[model samples]
Target chain A: GGIITQTPKFLIGQEGQKLTLKCQQNFNHDTMYWYRQDSGKGLRLIYYSITENDLQKGDLSEGYDASREKKSSFSLTVTSAQKNEMAVFLCASSRTGQDTQYFGPGTRLLVL
Target chain B: QQQVRQSPQSLTVWEGETAILNCSYEDSTFNYFPWYQQFPGEGPALLISIRSVSDKKEDGRFTIFFNKREKKLSLHITDSQPGDSATYFCAASLSNYNVLYFGSGTKLTVEP
Candidate 1:
Protein backbone atom coordinates (compact mmCIF):
# COMPACT_ATOMS: atom_id res chain seq x y z
CA GLY A 1 0.00 0.00 0.00
CA GLY A 2 1.08 3.60 -0.64
CA ILE A 3 -0.08 7.13 0.03
CA ILE A 4 0.19 10.43 -1.84
CA THR A 5 0.63 13.62 0.15
CA GLN A 6 0.00 17.18 -0.94
CA THR A 7 1.33 20.26 0.80
CA PRO A 8 -0.54 23.40 1.89
CA LYS A 9 -4.03 21.91 1.92
CA PHE A 10 -5.37 25.45 1.45
CA LEU A 11 -3.83 28.27 -0.56
CA ILE A 12 -4.73 31.95 -0.80
CA GLY A 13 -3.09 33.91 -3.58
CA GLN A 14 -3.42 37.44 -4.85
CA GLU A 15 -4.14 38.26 -8.45
CA GLY A 16 -1.01 38.02 -10.60
CA GLN A 17 0.89 36.26 -7.87
CA LYS A 18 2.79 33.07 -8.39
CA LEU A 19 1.98 29.95 -6.40
CA THR A 20 3.46 26.50 -6.20
CA LEU A 21 1.85 23.21 -5.14
CA LYS A 22 3.88 20.18 -4.17
CA CYS A 23 3.11 16.50 -4.21
CA GLN A 24 4.94 13.43 -2.89
CA GLN A 25 4.18 9.78 -3.40
CA ASN A 26 5.59 6.62 -1.91
CA PHE A 27 4.24 4.17 -4.45
CA ASN A 28 7.47 4.18 -6.45
CA HIS A 29 5.30 4.77 -9.48
CA ASP A 30 6.77 5.69 -12.84
CA THR A 31 4.12 8.10 -14.01
CA MET A 32 2.92 11.30 -12.33
CA TYR A 33 0.27 13.83 -13.30
CA TRP A 34 -1.24 17.18 -12.33
CA TYR A 35 -4.88 18.00 -12.86
CA ARG A 36 -7.09 21.00 -12.16
CA GLN A 37 -10.71 20.67 -11.11
CA ASP A 38 -13.10 23.59 -11.27
CA SER A 39 -16.46 23.69 -9.55
CA GLY A 40 -19.06 21.61 -11.40
CA LYS A 41 -16.48 20.64 -14.01
CA GLY A 42 -14.49 17.53 -14.72
CA LEU A 43 -10.81 17.33 -13.96
CA ARG A 44 -8.46 18.57 -16.69
CA LEU A 45 -4.94 17.47 -17.12
CA ILE A 46 -2.28 20.16 -16.73
CA TYR A 47 0.92 18.18 -17.04
CA TYR A 48 2.40 14.73 -16.67
CA SER A 49 5.80 13.17 -16.17
CA ILE A 50 6.74 9.78 -17.45
CA THR A 51 9.85 9.75 -15.34
CA GLU A 52 12.07 12.06 -13.33
CA ASN A 53 12.90 15.33 -15.16
CA ASP A 54 10.54 14.47 -17.99
CA LEU A 55 7.47 16.60 -18.68
CA GLN A 56 4.52 16.51 -21.02
CA LYS A 57 1.84 19.16 -21.48
CA GLY A 58 -1.88 18.45 -21.38
CA ASP A 59 -5.03 20.20 -22.53
CA LEU A 60 -4.86 22.88 -19.81
CA SER A 61 -1.16 23.61 -19.63
CA GLU A 62 -1.25 27.20 -20.84
CA GLY A 63 -0.80 28.99 -17.51
CA TYR A 64 0.88 26.23 -15.55
CA ASP A 65 4.32 24.67 -15.41
CA ALA A 66 5.37 21.40 -13.84
CA SER A 67 8.61 19.99 -12.51
CA ARG A 68 9.72 16.48 -11.69
CA GLU A 69 13.01 16.88 -9.92
CA LYS A 70 12.88 13.42 -8.39
CA LYS A 71 11.09 10.17 -9.01
CA SER A 72 8.97 10.50 -5.89
CA SER A 73 8.00 14.15 -6.21
CA PHE A 74 6.16 16.37 -8.68
CA SER A 75 5.32 20.05 -8.42
CA LEU A 76 3.12 22.53 -10.25
CA THR A 77 3.41 26.29 -10.44
CA VAL A 78 0.77 28.81 -11.41
CA THR A 79 2.50 31.52 -13.43
CA SER A 80 -0.03 34.21 -12.59
CA ALA A 81 -3.12 33.82 -10.54
CA GLN A 82 -6.40 34.93 -12.01
CA LYS A 83 -8.68 37.20 -10.05
CA ASN A 84 -11.48 35.51 -8.17
CA GLU A 85 -10.27 32.15 -9.42
CA MET A 86 -10.88 29.11 -7.27
CA ALA A 87 -10.06 25.50 -8.02
CA VAL A 88 -8.64 22.30 -6.65
CA PHE A 89 -5.32 21.00 -7.89
CA LEU A 90 -4.80 17.27 -7.76
CA CYS A 91 -1.68 15.11 -7.95
CA ALA A 92 -1.72 11.52 -9.03
CA SER A 93 0.71 8.68 -9.75
CA SER A 94 0.47 5.39 -11.54
CA ARG A 95 2.60 2.32 -11.80
CA THR A 96 2.62 2.76 -15.56
CA GLY A 97 1.34 5.28 -18.03
CA GLN A 98 -1.72 3.16 -18.73
CA ASP A 99 -2.31 1.92 -15.20
CA THR A 100 -4.68 3.02 -12.49
CA GLN A 101 -3.69 6.29 -10.83
CA TYR A 102 -3.64 7.02 -7.11
CA PHE A 103 -4.49 10.57 -6.08
CA GLY A 104 -3.59 12.84 -3.23
CA PRO A 105 -6.02 14.71 -0.98
CA GLY A 106 -5.65 17.84 -3.20
CA THR A 107 -4.82 21.49 -2.59
CA ARG A 108 -7.67 23.97 -2.72
CA LEU A 109 -6.70 27.38 -4.10
CA LEU A 110 -8.51 30.70 -3.88
CA VAL A 111 -7.29 33.75 -5.75
CA LEU A 112 -8.39 37.19 -4.69
CA GLN B 1 -14.65 19.88 -27.09
CA GLN B 2 -15.74 17.53 -24.33
CA GLN B 3 -14.71 14.01 -25.21
CA VAL B 4 -16.74 12.41 -22.42
CA ARG B 5 -20.26 13.23 -21.22
CA GLN B 6 -22.44 12.20 -18.29
CA SER B 7 -26.21 12.31 -17.94
CA PRO B 8 -28.30 13.70 -15.05
CA GLN B 9 -26.26 16.32 -13.28
CA SER B 10 -27.76 15.18 -10.00
CA LEU B 11 -29.73 12.17 -8.76
CA THR B 12 -31.46 11.30 -5.50
CA VAL B 13 -32.24 7.73 -4.50
CA TRP B 14 -33.64 6.13 -1.38
CA GLU B 15 -31.55 3.83 0.71
CA GLY B 16 -31.51 0.19 -0.47
CA GLU B 17 -32.56 1.33 -3.94
CA THR B 18 -30.46 1.15 -7.06
CA ALA B 19 -28.69 4.23 -8.45
CA ILE B 20 -27.74 4.32 -12.07
CA LEU B 21 -25.33 6.78 -13.67
CA ASN B 22 -24.74 6.99 -17.39
CA CYS B 23 -21.71 8.08 -19.39
CA SER B 24 -20.82 8.34 -23.06
CA TYR B 25 -17.65 9.04 -24.98
CA GLU B 26 -16.96 10.66 -28.32
CA ASP B 27 -13.72 8.85 -29.01
CA SER B 28 -13.99 5.28 -30.12
CA THR B 29 -10.27 4.81 -29.72
CA PHE B 30 -10.63 4.99 -25.97
CA ASN B 31 -10.45 1.45 -24.73
CA TYR B 32 -10.15 1.93 -20.99
CA PHE B 33 -12.97 3.21 -18.77
CA PRO B 34 -12.84 4.08 -15.11
CA TRP B 35 -15.40 5.34 -12.62
CA TYR B 36 -14.36 7.60 -9.78
CA GLN B 37 -16.08 8.66 -6.54
CA GLN B 38 -15.45 11.94 -4.80
CA PHE B 39 -16.63 13.28 -1.47
CA PRO B 40 -16.63 16.94 -0.59
CA GLY B 41 -13.20 18.46 0.05
CA GLU B 42 -11.36 15.35 -1.09
CA GLY B 43 -9.73 14.14 -4.26
CA PRO B 44 -11.54 11.67 -6.46
CA ALA B 45 -10.80 7.99 -5.94
CA LEU B 46 -11.02 5.13 -8.39
CA LEU B 47 -14.20 3.13 -7.80
CA ILE B 48 -14.35 0.61 -10.63
CA SER B 49 -13.09 0.13 -14.15
CA ILE B 50 -13.56 -1.99 -17.25
CA ARG B 51 -11.78 -2.49 -20.51
CA SER B 52 -13.35 -2.30 -23.94
CA VAL B 53 -12.85 -6.02 -24.34
CA SER B 54 -15.31 -6.74 -21.55
CA ASP B 55 -18.95 -5.75 -21.71
CA LYS B 56 -19.53 -6.06 -17.99
CA LYS B 57 -17.52 -5.77 -14.81
CA GLU B 58 -18.78 -6.23 -11.26
CA ASP B 59 -17.33 -5.59 -7.86
CA GLY B 60 -19.39 -6.27 -4.80
CA ARG B 61 -22.54 -4.17 -5.15
CA PHE B 62 -21.10 -1.99 -7.91
CA THR B 63 -21.51 -3.05 -11.49
CA ILE B 64 -20.39 -1.45 -14.74
CA PHE B 65 -22.25 -2.24 -17.93
CA PHE B 66 -20.54 -1.24 -21.14
CA ASN B 67 -21.94 -1.00 -24.65
CA LYS B 68 -19.06 -0.84 -27.04
CA ARG B 69 -21.30 -0.56 -30.05
CA GLU B 70 -23.06 2.45 -28.53
CA LYS B 71 -19.96 4.08 -27.04
CA LYS B 72 -21.73 4.25 -23.70
CA LEU B 73 -21.45 2.76 -20.24
CA SER B 74 -23.45 2.77 -17.03
CA LEU B 75 -22.71 2.28 -13.35
CA HIS B 76 -25.23 0.60 -11.12
CA ILE B 77 -25.05 0.74 -7.35
CA THR B 78 -27.33 -1.63 -5.50
CA ASP B 79 -28.48 -1.20 -1.91
CA SER B 80 -27.18 2.32 -1.93
CA GLN B 81 -26.64 3.90 1.48
CA PRO B 82 -26.24 7.44 2.69
CA GLY B 83 -22.54 6.81 2.84
CA ASP B 84 -22.62 6.26 -0.91
CA SER B 85 -23.68 9.83 -1.56
CA ALA B 86 -20.96 11.50 -3.58
CA THR B 87 -20.05 12.83 -7.00
CA TYR B 88 -19.30 10.18 -9.63
CA PHE B 89 -17.06 10.76 -12.61
CA CYS B 90 -16.59 8.63 -15.68
CA ALA B 91 -13.28 8.75 -17.49
CA ALA B 92 -11.88 7.22 -20.66
CA SER B 93 -8.43 6.79 -22.06
CA LEU B 94 -6.62 5.16 -24.92
CA SER B 95 -4.50 2.09 -24.43
CA ASN B 96 -1.35 3.80 -25.67
CA TYR B 97 -2.01 7.24 -24.25
CA ASN B 98 -2.49 7.13 -20.53
CA VAL B 99 -4.10 10.54 -20.11
CA LEU B 100 -7.73 10.25 -19.06
CA TYR B 101 -10.62 12.34 -20.38
CA PHE B 102 -13.25 12.76 -17.68
CA GLY B 103 -16.96 13.48 -17.81
CA SER B 104 -18.44 16.40 -15.93
CA GLY B 105 -19.69 14.12 -13.15
CA THR B 106 -23.02 13.21 -11.54
CA LYS B 107 -23.81 14.13 -7.99
CA LEU B 108 -25.69 11.34 -6.20
CA THR B 109 -27.53 11.59 -2.92
CA VAL B 110 -28.93 8.57 -1.11
CA GLU B 111 -31.66 9.42 1.35
CA PRO B 112 -32.27 7.24 4.33
Candidate 2:
Protein backbone atom coordinates (compact mmCIF):
# COMPACT_ATOMS: atom_id res chain seq x y z
CA GLY A 1 0.00 0.00 0.00
CA GLY A 2 1.26 3.46 -0.86
CA ILE A 3 0.98 6.49 1.38
CA ILE A 4 0.40 10.23 0.86
CA THR A 5 2.51 12.51 3.03
CA GLN A 6 1.85 16.19 3.69
CA THR A 7 4.43 18.42 5.31
CA PRO A 8 3.87 20.86 8.17
CA LYS A 9 0.97 19.52 10.15
CA PHE A 10 0.21 23.00 11.46
CA LEU A 11 0.78 26.47 10.06
CA ILE A 12 0.31 29.97 11.40
CA GLY A 13 0.44 32.86 8.97
CA GLN A 14 -0.07 36.59 9.18
CA GLU A 15 -2.59 38.42 7.05
CA GLY A 16 -1.54 38.92 3.42
CA GLN A 17 1.39 36.54 3.80
CA LYS A 18 2.03 33.70 1.43
CA LEU A 19 2.29 30.07 2.52
CA THR A 20 2.98 26.88 0.67
CA LEU A 21 1.90 23.33 1.51
CA LYS A 22 3.62 20.35 0.03
CA CYS A 23 2.38 16.82 -0.66
CA GLN A 24 4.15 13.68 -1.76
CA GLN A 25 2.66 10.35 -2.71
CA ASN A 26 4.37 7.00 -3.03
CA PHE A 27 1.54 5.28 -4.86
CA ASN A 28 2.82 6.45 -8.23
CA HIS A 29 -0.67 7.64 -9.04
CA ASP A 30 -1.20 9.89 -12.02
CA THR A 31 -3.81 12.14 -10.45
CA MET A 32 -3.47 14.31 -7.35
CA TYR A 33 -5.73 16.86 -5.71
CA TRP A 34 -5.74 19.64 -3.14
CA TYR A 35 -8.75 20.46 -1.01
CA ARG A 36 -9.65 22.88 1.77
CA GLN A 37 -11.91 22.11 4.69
CA ASP A 38 -13.25 24.53 7.24
CA SER A 39 -14.42 23.36 10.63
CA GLY A 40 -17.71 21.46 10.31
CA LYS A 41 -17.59 21.71 6.52
CA GLY A 42 -16.92 19.23 3.78
CA LEU A 43 -13.79 19.25 1.70
CA ARG A 44 -13.74 21.68 -1.22
CA LEU A 45 -11.57 21.04 -4.19
CA ILE A 46 -8.92 23.68 -4.74
CA TYR A 47 -6.79 22.32 -7.52
CA TYR A 48 -5.76 19.07 -9.15
CA SER A 49 -3.21 17.70 -11.57
CA ILE A 50 -3.73 14.81 -13.92
CA THR A 51 -0.03 14.35 -14.58
CA GLU A 52 3.22 16.18 -14.33
CA ASN A 53 2.88 19.74 -15.67
CA ASP A 54 -0.87 19.40 -16.00
CA LEU A 55 -3.12 21.55 -13.84
CA GLN A 56 -6.90 21.77 -13.49
CA LYS A 57 -8.94 24.26 -11.52
CA GLY A 58 -11.75 23.18 -9.29
CA ASP A 59 -14.61 25.01 -7.57
CA LEU A 60 -12.51 26.66 -4.88
CA SER A 61 -9.37 27.32 -6.87
CA GLU A 62 -9.54 31.09 -6.88
CA GLY A 63 -7.33 31.66 -3.83
CA TYR A 64 -4.79 28.90 -4.40
CA ASP A 65 -2.10 27.92 -6.84
CA ALA A 66 -0.73 24.43 -7.42
CA SER A 67 2.19 22.70 -9.08
CA ARG A 68 2.92 19.15 -10.13
CA GLU A 69 6.60 19.03 -10.94
CA LYS A 70 6.72 15.23 -10.87
CA LYS A 71 4.39 12.28 -10.72
CA SER A 72 4.99 11.79 -7.01
CA SER A 73 4.76 15.31 -5.69
CA PHE A 74 2.21 18.14 -5.74
CA SER A 75 2.28 21.47 -3.99
CA LEU A 76 -0.18 24.26 -3.21
CA THR A 77 0.41 27.91 -2.42
CA VAL A 78 -1.94 30.23 -0.63
CA THR A 79 -1.69 33.39 -2.70
CA SER A 80 -2.51 35.63 0.23
CA ALA A 81 -3.55 34.66 3.70
CA GLN A 82 -6.79 36.07 5.03
CA LYS A 83 -7.02 37.55 8.49
CA ASN A 84 -8.60 35.29 11.08
CA GLU A 85 -8.92 32.52 8.50
CA MET A 86 -8.90 28.97 9.80
CA ALA A 87 -8.93 25.92 7.58
CA VAL A 88 -7.34 22.58 6.88
CA PHE A 89 -5.88 21.69 3.52
CA LEU A 90 -5.98 18.07 2.43
CA CYS A 91 -4.09 16.25 -0.29
CA ALA A 92 -5.18 13.08 -2.03
CA SER A 93 -4.18 10.85 -4.93
CA SER A 94 -5.84 8.24 -7.07
CA ARG A 95 -5.01 6.09 -10.02
CA THR A 96 -6.35 6.82 -13.50
CA GLY A 97 -10.05 6.46 -14.22
CA GLN A 98 -12.48 5.58 -11.44
CA ASP A 99 -10.58 4.45 -8.37
CA THR A 100 -10.49 4.83 -4.64
CA GLN A 101 -8.48 7.79 -3.43
CA TYR A 102 -5.93 7.86 -0.61
CA PHE A 103 -5.55 10.96 1.53
CA GLY A 104 -2.74 12.46 3.55
CA PRO A 105 -2.81 14.00 7.00
CA GLY A 106 -4.08 17.57 6.51
CA THR A 107 -2.21 20.84 6.97
CA ARG A 108 -4.03 23.07 9.40
CA LEU A 109 -3.66 26.78 8.57
CA LEU A 110 -4.56 29.70 10.74
CA VAL A 111 -4.11 33.30 9.67
CA LEU A 112 -3.69 35.67 12.56
CA GLN B 1 -18.36 22.28 -4.74
CA GLN B 2 -20.92 21.39 -7.43
CA GLN B 3 -23.97 21.89 -5.31
CA VAL B 4 -24.03 18.51 -3.65
CA ARG B 5 -26.65 18.86 -0.90
CA GLN B 6 -26.48 17.06 2.44
CA SER B 7 -28.75 17.08 5.43
CA PRO B 8 -28.50 16.45 9.14
CA GLN B 9 -25.25 18.32 9.47
CA SER B 10 -24.79 16.38 12.72
CA LEU B 11 -26.20 13.18 14.13
CA THR B 12 -25.97 11.37 17.47
CA VAL B 13 -26.74 7.71 17.88
CA TRP B 14 -26.40 5.22 20.70
CA GLU B 15 -23.88 2.46 20.40
CA GLY B 16 -25.27 -0.67 18.71
CA GLU B 17 -27.78 1.46 16.83
CA THR B 18 -27.72 2.41 13.19
CA ALA B 19 -26.63 5.72 11.75
CA ILE B 20 -27.59 6.98 8.33
CA LEU B 21 -26.04 9.88 6.44
CA ASN B 22 -27.67 11.38 3.38
CA CYS B 23 -26.31 13.19 0.32
CA SER B 24 -27.60 14.43 -3.03
CA TYR B 25 -26.07 16.07 -6.05
CA GLU B 26 -27.25 18.13 -9.02
CA ASP B 27 -24.58 17.13 -11.50
CA SER B 28 -26.01 14.61 -13.89
CA THR B 29 -22.59 13.88 -15.28
CA PHE B 30 -21.33 12.40 -12.05
CA ASN B 31 -21.07 8.64 -12.36
CA TYR B 32 -19.01 7.72 -9.32
CA PHE B 33 -20.01 8.27 -5.73
CA PRO B 34 -17.83 7.78 -2.67
CA TRP B 35 -18.05 8.27 1.06
CA TYR B 36 -15.22 9.31 3.34
CA GLN B 37 -14.71 9.09 7.07
CA GLN B 38 -12.60 11.59 8.96
CA PHE B 39 -11.42 11.86 12.52
CA PRO B 40 -10.18 14.97 14.24
CA GLY B 41 -6.61 15.92 13.34
CA GLU B 42 -6.57 13.29 10.62
CA GLY B 43 -7.22 13.06 6.91
CA PRO B 44 -10.39 11.64 5.45
CA ALA B 45 -10.34 8.02 4.34
CA LEU B 46 -12.41 6.34 1.66
CA LEU B 47 -14.92 4.19 3.45
CA ILE B 48 -17.06 2.86 0.62
CA SER B 49 -18.36 3.74 -2.82
CA ILE B 50 -20.84 2.79 -5.53
CA ARG B 51 -21.12 3.49 -9.19
CA SER B 52 -24.17 5.02 -10.81
CA VAL B 53 -25.07 1.71 -12.39
CA SER B 54 -25.25 -0.03 -9.04
CA ASP B 55 -27.89 0.58 -6.43
CA LYS B 56 -25.88 -0.58 -3.46
CA LYS B 57 -22.39 -1.52 -2.34
CA GLU B 58 -21.37 -2.96 0.98
CA ASP B 59 -18.12 -3.36 2.87
CA GLY B 60 -18.21 -5.04 6.24
CA ARG B 61 -20.31 -2.71 8.44
CA PHE B 62 -20.58 0.15 5.98
CA THR B 63 -22.96 0.27 3.05
CA ILE B 64 -23.59 2.75 0.23
CA PHE B 65 -26.98 3.02 -1.42
CA PHE B 66 -27.34 4.96 -4.61
CA ASN B 67 -30.35 6.32 -6.43
CA LYS B 68 -29.48 7.32 -9.90
CA ARG B 69 -32.81 8.77 -10.84
CA GLU B 70 -33.20 10.92 -7.78
CA LYS B 71 -29.62 12.08 -7.99
CA LYS B 72 -29.20 11.04 -4.40
CA LEU B 73 -27.27 8.55 -2.26
CA SER B 74 -26.67 7.53 1.31
CA LEU B 75 -24.33 5.68 3.68
CA HIS B 76 -25.63 3.45 6.40
CA ILE B 77 -23.55 2.13 9.28
CA THR B 78 -25.10 -0.80 11.06
CA ASP B 79 -24.59 -1.50 14.73
CA SER B 80 -22.66 1.69 15.10
CA GLN B 81 -19.76 1.65 17.51
CA PRO B 82 -18.25 4.40 19.60
CA GLY B 83 -15.22 4.22 17.41
CA ASP B 84 -17.42 5.36 14.54
CA SER B 85 -17.68 8.84 15.94
CA ALA B 86 -16.37 11.01 13.15
CA THR B 87 -17.34 13.25 10.25
CA TYR B 88 -18.54 11.67 7.02
CA PHE B 89 -18.43 13.24 3.58
CA CYS B 90 -20.17 12.19 0.39
CA ALA B 91 -18.58 12.96 -2.95
CA ALA B 92 -19.44 12.78 -6.63
CA SER B 93 -17.30 12.91 -9.72
CA LEU B 94 -17.68 12.75 -13.44
CA SER B 95 -15.30 11.04 -15.82
CA ASN B 96 -14.34 14.37 -17.33
CA TYR B 97 -13.57 16.36 -14.19
CA ASN B 98 -11.43 13.74 -12.45
CA VAL B 99 -12.29 15.54 -9.24
CA LEU B 100 -14.90 14.96 -6.61
CA TYR B 101 -17.56 17.44 -5.54
CA PHE B 102 -18.16 17.00 -1.83
CA GLY B 103 -21.01 17.75 0.53
CA SER B 104 -20.61 19.92 3.59
CA GLY B 105 -20.35 16.75 5.72
CA THR B 106 -22.26 15.01 8.46
CA LYS B 107 -20.79 14.64 11.92
CA LEU B 108 -21.87 11.39 13.52
CA THR B 109 -21.28 10.49 17.14
CA VAL B 110 -21.98 7.02 18.43
CA GLU B 111 -22.33 7.36 22.15
CA PRO B 112 -22.23 4.52 24.58
Model 1, span B42-110: residue lDDT tens: 888999999999999999999999999999999999999999999999999986476999999999999
Q: Residue-wise lDDT of candidate 2 within B1-112, one digit each (tens)?
A: 3578787899999999989999999988798888889998889998888889899999998998898889989899999999999999988887545778889999999999
The whole-model C-alpha lDDT of candidate 1 against the native structure comes to 0.95
**lDDT for residue B60 in candidate 1, whole number 0-100:** 96
Per-residue lDDT tens digits for candidate 2, residues A1-112, read 9999998899999999989999999999999999999876788889989999999998899988999999999999999999999999999999887568789999999999
Relative to the true structure, how large is the alpha-carbon lDDT of every model?
0.95, 0.90
Q: Top model by DockQ, which number?
A: 1
Mark the regions of model 1 whose C-alpha exceeds 4 Å error after superposition.
Answer: none
Kindly report which residue pairs in candidate 1 clash with one another. Answer: none
Clash totals, every prediction: 0, 1
What TM-score does candidate 2 reach? 0.95
